[model samples]
Target: MWLEQMLAAAGRSGAFYEGKRRAGQYFLRYELPRTEAQFALLESLDRTTLDMPADCI
Candidate 1:
């Protein structure tokens, strides 16, 4: 599974961060595009636009 591979890679690469969780959950969620158009729109955005303000995470 892609999620499993991603987690494994993160663990091996020391990229994993600890986060709060509820019960047995990992407290992480994935948001997938509902349609191809949404995906295309997201893909069209320039990477620079994704940078956050220095004060904001």
Candidate 2:
């Protein structure tokens, strides 16, 4: 969202150019892959807090 806002501020709305493209490439190559691993870890969890309440802590 911040990136989109920055692009819009620069009149590049909904378009990824140069640095934006590089940022997206970096995310896809690095950060995006972490999501699958994180999700796998979460999926392996035993639902320990499925019914937990927000204020419980």
Candidate 3:
């Protein structure tokens, strides 16, 4: 699944770690669904970009 892939990528980059540190929650919210654009963004995201937070990256 795409979410699984995203989570794995986040794990590798430490973005998930940072998010957990700040939010006391998972790196991503479960309720808000991803759009097609968001999936495209994920596909296009490279290593350096993946190091940033999910909101603006």
Candidate 4:
């Protein structure tokens, strides 16, 4: 469910688009935060799985 929500947000943001192929693989590209504190928070959040997936936001 979280993955689905993330994908939807990404699609809305134009960060991901439907590819020519109809397979399971979807195309996605986006800019990530570039600060130490941000990276650390991301890492910690990822480890804990407390927040939604990266694309969810």
Residue range 1-57, candidate 2, lDDT tens digits: 535634545645454455675675677688877899879978898676776887896
Clash count list over all predictions: 0, 0, 0, 0
User: Ten consecutive residues with minimal summed lDDT in candidate 4?
Assistant: 20-29
Say which candidate scores most in lDDT: 2
Clashing pairs in 2: none
Give candidate 2's error at residue 9 in angstroms.
14
Ranked candidates (lDDT, high to low): 2, 3, 1, 4
Candidate 1 C-alpha lDDT tens digits along 1-57: 444544545534332422212211332343333456777878888575568677775
| lDDT of each candidate versus the true structure | 0.46, 0.66, 0.54, 0.45
Better of 2 and 4 by TM-score: 2
User: Clashes in model 3: which pairs?
Assistant: none
TM-score rank order: 2, 1, 3, 4
List candidate 1 segments past 4 Å from native. 1-33
TM-score of 2: 0.47
Query: What is every candidate's alpha-carbon RMSD to the true fold?
Result: 11.5, 6.7, 15.1, 14.3
